[model samples]
Target: MSVEIALTPQNPTHAGLSGRLVCFPHAGGAAERFHDWISGFAPVLDVRAVTLPGRGRLMDQSPVESWPDLIESIVTRLQPLADRPFAIFGHSFGARLAYEVTRALADDEQAPNLLIVAGPAPQMAQRDRKISGLPRPAFLAEIEAINGTPPEVLANTDLMDRMLPALRADFALLETYEADRASKHSPLPCPILAVGSDNDPQVPFHSILGWRHRTRSRFECRLFAGDHFFPFTNPDFADTLFDYVDDALNEHTKDLHRAG
Candidate 1:
């Protein structure tokens, strides 16, 4: 279950943009994670990075539960932007949400043209066993073990205290998320582009292949250099996304031309 995250798009340009690319952040991540990086992908794709409550721009706000409510709220806020062709991109924890949201909109006008699931594959995706409910020390350790959380953030007590709620909320969202019967058996019609890093423990090369089962249409997998957070560490990671987006759009255009 993709939790109910109350992230309204902050970028006004999304309303009039041609096609939307809704990017969901990893666990404990803020919308800014992909927002600033996708400046180059603008115009062609209106990339809207989801800003959940209690982190990033919404740090002052209380975090909502990562359950049905979060997913419902995300759908409600993102519905209007589905006027044109769109893609759903999620990294690590965000990947599940993207898939779930796509399933939620299976019959609607908001159905995504493609799903770019980055980082962990569904079988071994980023969901810890109830770290959200763990004690402060244990929770922090788990986050650190994931290797995605920076050392500076862990070192800074003030920052950790402030961001702890959002982190825990996101963890809980993934933790309690059980694959429903429909999502388990029913594969999405849209194509899926699964991406991961070869060296990343969270996303083993073979594990990424499991995404093939989740899609009824096309499935493509690409591995990059670096760890799970390659997007942040390697600038080339952004290029990969752009390339995939361009390829998908081109294929879609060909399909449309043939149809006409």
Candidate 2:
């Protein structure tokens, strides 16, 4: 499957101002999901929401099945715009994907300044039940139980038809993923911000704490007031994320000035 994502805001050239933030979407999510939040990043930051194939305009294309291939595809396509300082953010499955992409960029001199992950955390706990192969009714029930999918989409047959394939492919990607054993290896160089919810039905507390072990630089966590979907559902997500980036970038500026 030849899959390439044309990130929104295309070139992302920063004009030597602030860094750009590249956002990856959750399972069955498209890049357009972050459209409303781009303005929040404003002049100080450039934001690019990656649109994976197999949804929206690319509905006819086959979704990439292998995680490595998918990561490489994203990294290859993103290399052009990575000229200046930048960061990467993702939610749930996208979070892990973002991390892997960061790893792929490891050999490069100019890596992401920070990483922000929401919804799912890295985990040691194993899932007792698998949601991937469940019957149609059961599958929808599981997705709904976790509050990851909207009820309106479930109610619409046409929408469900378009959504299920991509959802299943994303689930399979997660199933095949081999989580990084932070203790066994060196942590990533950039700081990480792990965002979660007190009541996220899908991702547990261990998931949040796992991020601490994965970062060699700095690590921060923010817990919001909703469930698994809080990253996108909460009205204040843009403000919260923006403030964190602002603070991080500001400190980065100071560090650069000090070194100079």
Q: List, residue by residue over 105-195, the lDDT tens digit for candidate 2.
A: 7656456888998845544423456787788889888877767666666788887878788787877777666544424545788898988
Ten-residue region with minimum lDDT total, candidate 1: 1-10
Model 1, runs deviating above 4 Å? 1-18, 123-128, 179-183, 257-260
RMSD of each: 3.1, 2.5
Candidate 2 residue spans exceeding 4 A from truth: 10-16, 123-128, 180-185, 257-260
Per residue, candidate 1 scores C-alpha lDDT tens digits across 17-56 of: 5456788888778776775655777656677788788888
Number of clashing pairs per prediction, in order: 8, 0
